[model samples]
Target: MSGLQPLGSVDICLVTMPFVDLCRPSIALGLLKSALKSSPYRVSVSYGNLLFAEKVGVERYGLQKFGRQTRLAGDWVFAQAAFPEHVTDTSDFAQQIAQDIRRLAGLDRDPETLNRLAELVLDLRDQATAFVDEMVESVLAQTPRIVACTSVFQQHTASLALLRKLKERDPELITIIGGANCTGVMGVANIESFPWIDVIFSGEADDQFAPLIDHLMRSGLAGLDAACLEGVITKTSAIQLRDVSGKDLPCAFVSDLVTSPQPDYEDYFTTLRQVSYRDQIVPGIPLESSRGCWWGHKCGCTFCGLNGHNMRYRAKRADQVLNEIRSLRQTYGIERIEFVDNILDMGFFDDLLPRLANEPRKFNIFFETKANLTRTQVGRLKAAGVGWIQPGIEALHDQMLKLMNKGTTNAINLQLLKYACEFGLRVIWHVLYRLPGEEDAWHGESAKLVPLLHHLMPPTNFVPVTVQRFSAYHDDPEKYGLKLQVAPGYLDIYPLDVERIGQLAYFFDSNLDYPSAHDRHDGFLALNKAIRDWKRAFANEDAPPILGMRDEGESIFILDTRACATERRFRLEGIQADVLRCCDPALRSERLAPVLAEHHGRRYTESAIAQAVEALRERRLLVEVSGKLLQLAVPGEIPDLPARSTFPGGIDAPPNLAALIGASAKTAVAA
Candidate 1:
């Protein structure tokens, strides 16, 4: 093993931020690993993203509300799609199903629903744990002492728990915690709460970690307290009291997790984890180009963790980034490369892509960015073979966008979106609903959003967000005037304390006021109630009829009866309405018939028509494939729309302009 081969002993293990799958361990532990070289202590590094079931509940419940329809629909599609021979040969599908139940700890899922989703995630977690454990043990055999766990996502909670289990098996091991979440809340100690975590470094752990490890190796735990631990919070303190230094840590540290030979992938294995191929997967090398946000500093949105607000950008040399890319492709059969940066800078991308474009081996690439990238940037990226970019466009309202400080206006956002679409680049957008805004405001914003959906449609992507912790209003409720208290539920991860930095600490027991001018809690509350009611009504067997119109053929499938009812309520007078999903198209007859007859001329009761449609579905007259948006095999024909031509740069010609009216045409006509 390398531990015995004299690279330096592993005295400390460090995890990176967002311990989620994309965590670039190479960046977090890379520098410290290098500094320790030639030292007597051997270094073994492992990264972790912890798993707390309760936190999962909070997150999942919110997700369920936001994406319940789509995700459920996706799962059904995945289940119906036959498993490939490789997947089926690897494991027993039945056994995998059983394991999913045990792993989910009773997460909400119906008996017939695709339980494979749970199984897949559990399999990945197991593979990740086993792989990390083996690597640690290999180093530990040579007398490695410390183990560090870093996380990018909430999953780090689970990784931390696994490390604790590993610690029990080897009491001599010391566990360290550091990452984004750790950086935010590390000044406080809850040693009793998490007995496994020792020496939690709150902020950037690079410079401080090596020195701390050196002291530990020399003195064997002596002078640990007096060490220069900036965000270090020991068991002795309840709050994350900032150090006297008063300076925030650096954005990201350099690490071997990058340069070091990719973990021996011969041992690399992943079991049915939710591994998404969203990005171009380069086999060996991935890049983390920047640290913190350039924008998130001031625009602390209510439900954000300051992702875009805490801006710290340090672009690596373009040549160096390209060199790493070249080495990975040459050394290993890796063609896909993922940019793990928070947001790939446009400048960096422009420099990197043009060089790689003419290379012998075309490298597929992926990155995330905020909304409103320019048309030129999109065109350049597409030419460069960049597959996609994920951006958070959380809400559509100016007020909501302002609250989130998304840094771009809707007009700009829409323009950038159109460019991305024009360039045929896939863009994934993050969306949120039912936040702290007026009911009418939400509906108005949604109205604006629905039209834009046609402009920014997805196969492309959409991720919905509900409120979460340490975001603007939640972090400092007093300033934001948010006063709704979080009820003590299974979903609560952190106590509502004003001083805390991590978890749900800033909740109100009673409704609180925002700046007196914008206090619309009453309206927000009413809107929230309606949303909840709508959700419940959809789930209920006994509910009223619904009528909806979906664009039959334009690469789109929409389910919205809510919009029509909301429109009628606001635009017309004396109309009370309840809209619900109907298995029977006949149900559309009662309410829809009169409305359609009155509006479009001709129709019967909604329920009567809906029942006939449902019967057709049963008889195969209207076939509904689970994953598909359209009901298959229904007899129908719609005339093709006229083809539109794009002028040089996707600009539309003026409607009144004659086709013959051109520069050459004018000369010919004059002659």
Candidate 2:
């Protein structure tokens, strides 16, 4: 490490490839750029994703970017250009991609659109080769000594293609690869399968990246050894880093998030302004206040492989987070901030949220949190300028939740939806089916309950459970009554043997014991139909369903416009209004009577309260789940929230109250 080059002597390039969202920069590369600020290396990030999007047309690139990840159509499109010798025939690949596009579009089984899409796939494949050549020329213009690519989601093939071309043109250039996809066995396999990659970091490289660069700059690759780099797998050390079965050795992880440098996003904004489709994108800066999952450390989700080998939760100090946000906002002049944490730190509730809520300039923020949030917490999230959240409401059945070890009940998830709707927070979630140990009858029961929730937000879509590497299901398939194989998509993309493909693959195809194929399809038909109807109802901009309530001194007024509403309006008085008010946060059936009696300052029998509750339930004013009664209507005073469809750009501007609810309920509930 001694006698290294002076600061900013060695040139390095960090790359982000296609299939990544065009609306955000790579936090991984951004952090690395900042991490090398004090070192002798001068880093420049190459935004190849934006460049490719411009070349292939932004709209078409988006179609592949947001398409199903299990299909890996994006990877296959670039695979032809990356490894020409292996992927000679793309006829079958084109047909599979065309069918997938048809499925995603909800199109009928027609050959006309499929034929056009098949041709388009071939055209894109050709464009991909030219795009890689363009990227190689762009990166080489900088004349960097080392080039590193961040591979996550569908960027693997594109990264490989760029690096392969770079190495072909310049044999002395060092090639490095890392990211979520390069963790554990996948990283080891990457070095073993692809001769172009010289070094692969298996875990978090926040603490190790700069030192490795120092070693390379001083002694060059010839002096580099396994002893010099701790968590990195070099080409010479791939065999020693793996066990007999070719799994990864234990790697060290970053223990403290406080020391991680603030990401540099100057390159992203610079490249974005040069793109033709820049106006269509409203960029959101990605920031991470924490890492890993706290809940997963206790009872991990069965199908999640997000944390890799590091499930320990760590967060930056509240002051550090606040300072970072202030600095980023002042520097970038962007109001949209997206937290890339796997799960929100619960401690943020006490310090970080309250601080953000008090800021003068509000930010449109997004975070992922557990679904078991209380009503007050949801309100705080909205008040803190958090307009979007993915609360992980995977299923509506308690049994299915238990099967996934979610540690939450259906009632809790429903309550979160109700509160998020009331507070104008847009929720992004979906239903996950095909879970092991799930009963076919659960779908039927969930379908029956779907209509009762027309006023709330609907799921984006329903997807089958995937067995991912590092997940509990993938680690011990026998325990969950599952048999696993590499997903079919990998076979089309990679020309490797089954064993090597298994090591490089993250998603997998699985077989479960319960819920036969016929039963699974038939049982989900009703639920699928219900969700479709719900989405359609929400699509109507003129008069979407609105179920809201207003509190008057004497009576409570309810306005109902749902498709399943029994009446347009209802006025509740006396005990009925009292019962609805008592159930604001939802109460168990047995506790409802006691709470109502206490509110009225008089003793009331359980039978009398039950009658009132049943009346409200019959009117669709209240719904019961797992013996807990929850008021279905949001407060009429609260304006309508923006759904994901309305604001596809992720910009949640303050809603115009007069436009949202002025026409619907102005006569019903006057101030």
Candidate 3:
């Protein structure tokens, strides 16, 4: 299957392109194929870019003298590792395209940079054209009646180019494309701009693709006949194939994900074995236990733009999830799985977690869950063979959390971190700063607790939150007091003139220009520096503990364990001990004042308690944001990982964030 197929005929060909997380095969293609495999449908999947990554990529890396296994198993390291460092630093595709257009139109600035960038763009265009030709020819060789490409991330341009080429090679092939990139107008824009993309599906195509395929098989590739398939857009007349987008088709199939068949990863595993360093591929079965985020379905996060118009929440039954997971594990002999759900189904705790916990196999799994998970739930997740989680821990301040519409408090986030550490679960969370309308005081207060969190698995990333295409920020900027920057990075990524890129680009920066680094807008810079310093210390195992609790006779001694502490230890008696214990998660100011009054009638005055809180904040022992307070120290040290050394920079200041988002930030600043 890795090589050219022998002459054969197939019903459909699904392709997953380059730059997707190579460690985890796409759950999209597999799920779609499973859905399409009804009575008369035969489905075939081709991970063309993955195959390219394995074969041609290995050969290229060999010339550079990379190690055998490293070169072979390097797909994840090379492709999915936010390897967009080069794109961000200088050779951003859209920026280059925009430059070329300007120069051609007789407007020029740095002509030399423009000339060099133009050359790079031409080279990439040539490469993409070749890839499209190759993929189309390969799929055509199998004689599939239809070819669909799963589009995500930077795969947009390549997918569009391929759809164009597929039609050029054979108009009868019925070219189609869909993914996060194709949601809403992004799809409409591509179809409106390029008429060759025969059919495009927006939003969740799982419900649309199968029925479309069925209709196409029955009615042939005639225009206006596709009116039955909702969310499927096509030209009105195939004879007059112009840049006219077809009527909007609606999605009918909810396809009860609870009872839907398990994903078919036959091709993924088949392709995995073809990787040169065969033993190096320890691929995980990418599973989806739920469709939409249950939490985000109601009061969605303000900054979250994922799920697009398809924010409706749907989850698989717990039994169905466990059965699917178990079947996948037994079938693949691979215990590691990465759940692709936007959020963990709350119902999983009732059945899936407990069942998986009791199962003999102890599979290693990873999931993303809401941060509001209780300590008991976190522990249950840990017990149930879940080794990793991406808890939605954007901030450790209630105000910041509220600004994001995260619906969870700082105390709850802290509690989740503590539980993750206590249960030995690896946490990957980010800290978003410089949020619009956020007070400078919020970050100033949040910075103090940065050092305290070093005991837990350090934040995997910290950067200013971006305005994504489908998020609440982009949906209605005015409602959230956000003025989005459209004529910038969006220009760099897509080739359309200023007007069109605004409608298509998924990522955007604020158009507000900060003339000086000293602006209040620069508050996040200092906070970012503090967080980076904290991360370095944590990585080196040098960060201090946040809490040290002990009972001596009738008195309790609680000490701030953070490094460089003046009052590392504090002794509390009676009422004071009771007050500190109430800081479990956090106690709001309104509630804290009353509780202290009730507990410490005469011993501690309101002013005295306020003074103590200020003292604690000064020592970085307490995170006092607005009225809520949390003891920042979680119970475990950041677990040292073997991949920690793979980070380009040294322990003093690791460079992942700098390599990934730092360049983008600098680009924004320069813009």
Candidate 4:
């Protein structure tokens, strides 16, 4: 390795393409650099997304649009579906685009307005192309021999366009591509379509990069073979692919996170300083503590299509993880670390949580874990500085959970919400429907439970299941009872044959086993409306703790803070009050009379106690389970969170109190 020649300047320039949040560095590019450290070739990384800053800085596009949530902005850099070339003098294109965007964002728009989106797109294309040219020229000025681009999600179209223009600027400039778009079938599809791209590399390029870099450095542009390296795809002809990406080889995940050098984030920082809106540059250092999902290997959630094909979970030792965290924190001056793991290994509770809690400087971290987490585990995670968690609570109905093969009961999902809320850990999750066996009754049952748990985070979005590649549904569509078609967005983005689009697409529109399930008369429509309102209501922080039981001497008072339900606080006394007191430590309703008679010197008939508890159940104040009765109220002061939604800052700024109290407080209070 030492025999390799020392070269000046960057011989290989890795470009990270766009559409991801600017707030986090690319873990793929970071890992690629770490894996390639053994190679003697001097490679420097570049953030091509920063080049879009040129368009953003010139006031071509408003900063408001780049706020991530904004529907549309002043300038458009990323090219979506093809604009009509025939309508050169079209005046309707810009107007149509504006109107469509306004309608989509729920802004006021007249349906009669004529559309001119095609014309506006031409102007946008010109601006975006100019921006790409300027940046490519600057990179070429460095006389780099090769430029490798990483494309994922929305980055694909933009990367393809840039590489085309870069090659047009100097056709001699070698172009290599990788990332999510370059894995599996999508990689070969892209390589065949885009002539400017010289090669495509699969997800794990550890065994692939060194030889390619050496070949480029030693041989220059001449005599370079298409099949020189593993995981490399090159042109065999005008439209054919010469792929040497040996699918059987070990991937990047096989490299230990514990042993791999901390991802070199210097390129990201350097790019950040050059961008115009440094204010928007809140970068979280990406740390891969593990890869794959332990649960997926057992019975993967069918709706999830994460971690690609690598579903076998592997994790670093606790000490190795801690040392990596310390090294990353010391090197990058940032405490926020986002784990790129598919699922937090169950072992983290044993191996990692205790050690992290003992550290002098606790990290503000985020992880995706199983929704069936215990209250004790949630508490331990918070103590270990896990500020946010995405527990997989897609639905809160036992039947739906079973249909999705989630392995956890709806009761368990609801328990997680209560526990996460009590522990002050921010829970972020979505509720998805449209499973093969899901019924309208299930959603209604979930909506009914929302009121009883207003203290916990509500579902962020209620969407139907999307068919994505590599999911259980995709692996065997008929088994899941679905017939899939390509999404319409891809028609505009790629404009290829429907069969080709279906093969290349990551997302698809699907036909269900029960098409009548989506009928207008279906009960899920009401559930959707209810969940939307619930999501809105839960975003408010100053709302009084809905499920907290307040003790007042002989009487037990409960505040009904459910915004959607028309109910007020409840008061119970005598035997009825004693019935709830037994539930404080949670005793069976059948045993309530004995506990009351033994401890409080109050005796009541079992028949009288049943009637009193039944009355409480009618009011939705008590949760009855089997013979046991658990209090609806979670005992504790509501813990704080970096609350979700449009209001974005940490801990100090919560959603407004007026918003939380909603429109029916005094009315419900009077009831």
Model 3 clash number: 11
lDDT of 2: 0.81
TM-score of 4: 0.80
- For every candidate in turn, the CA RMSD to the true structure comes to 19.9, 8.3, 8.6, 8.7
Ordering by TM-score: 2, 4, 3, 1
Mind giving the per-residue lDDT tens digits that candidate 3 earns over 482-539? Answer: 7886635343334456666665667776643432365664446656777877767666
Best by lDDT: 2
- Scanning candidate 3 in windows of ten residues, the lowest lDDT window is 64-73
**Model 3 TM-score (2 dp):** 0.78
Whole-model lDDT per candidate: 0.42, 0.81, 0.64, 0.65
C-alpha TM-scores of all predictions? 0.55, 0.92, 0.78, 0.80
Model 3 ranges off by over 4 Å: 1-8, 55-129, 223-227, 237-255, 277-280, 480-495, 514-522, 541-561, 567-578, 588-623, 632-671
Across residues 435-496, which tens digit of lDDT does each residue of candidate 1 receive? 45434455444443342133232322222233344455555666645564543221122222
Q: Cα lDDT for residue 525, model 3?
A: 60
Tens-digit lDDT track of model 2 for 1-671: 01111123238999999878888889999999998999867898888888887786676676574356787889988998788888555877787787877677665576755665666677778899988997887888778899999999899999999999999999999999998788878988898999988888878889989998888777668767745666688777777766734334635489999899999999888887877777877788889999989999888999898878569999999899888989988998877788989889988888999999999998878899999898889888988888889999999888888898988888888889889888988888999998888877788889888888887888988888888888999888999888899888888788799999999899998876334545446567888888899888977878978888998956999899998898999899977888888877778878877776777554667787889988998898887875688888888665667555333233212223223223223433453
Off by over 4 Å in 4: 1-8, 57-77, 80-104, 111-126, 206-208, 219-230, 236-256, 513-518, 550-559, 563-616, 624-631, 643-671
